[model samples]
Target: MGKFDDLPETRRKGLEKMEEVYGFDMSDGEGDFFRYTADHLFADIWNRPGLSNRDRRLFLIGMLVGQRANDVLGIQVPAALKNGELDEDALRELVILACHYDGWPNGSRMNAVVEDAIGKAKRAAGS
Candidate 1:
């Protein structure tokens, strides 16, 4: 059997939700960090119904920019675009808004990241 075959139902749901959010399979992730990310973060927190995925994504983008988490942003921005959670214009606007509150330096970095993600997403989509 596969390593994840015996995972609990919550883990399974988390994997599914991760795939949906990131637009890619997550079942191959291993180790405790991956497990908790799937089980706790994805399944429990992300699956909560109070906010839509887009809402959470916007919030996360702001937080990432504020934290200068460009590495994570590199992953999330692309996923948000691929999932149709946010479009190029919306992401551009978000960079302005988030940077306005966060800071100019962070905004500049985020703008570059956002543009790179847009280029990659467009290339991937053949757009």
Candidate 2:
């Protein structure tokens, strides 16, 4: 089977768009894991089978929620929305679920972050 490089031109363009909209450096910042994440996080893991990009975003949000990464969610939740992969309610569910795992305090913070992300995305889309 083909890897990420074998995807359609449109998909590749989407990936490039993600880099721009999400402000990620596809190039590694002079470290092994950094390069690995940059190269494979999208090109490999995100290109997996049996799941849509929306599914990938859902999983990513779940992981981020469980990890209590609200601080970074400011960027990432909006990034997921920019990828056309997340909706407001689904994002809210991620935050709500986080309360069960990461505690209500962290969930509250994530909720705020997700709200900001949704607002930012809506504004960017001029909606």
Best by TM-score: 1
lDDT of 2 by residue, 1-127 (tens): 4233565554454455457547564422446665455456655666668987666666766777777676666667887777666778877888788887878988888888988888877797896
Residue 116 lDDT in candidate 2: 89
TM-score of each: 0.89, 0.65
Best by lDDT: 1
Off by over 4 Å in 1: 1-6
| Global lDDT scores for all candidate models | 0.88, 0.68
Q: List the residue pairs that clash in candidate 2.
A: none
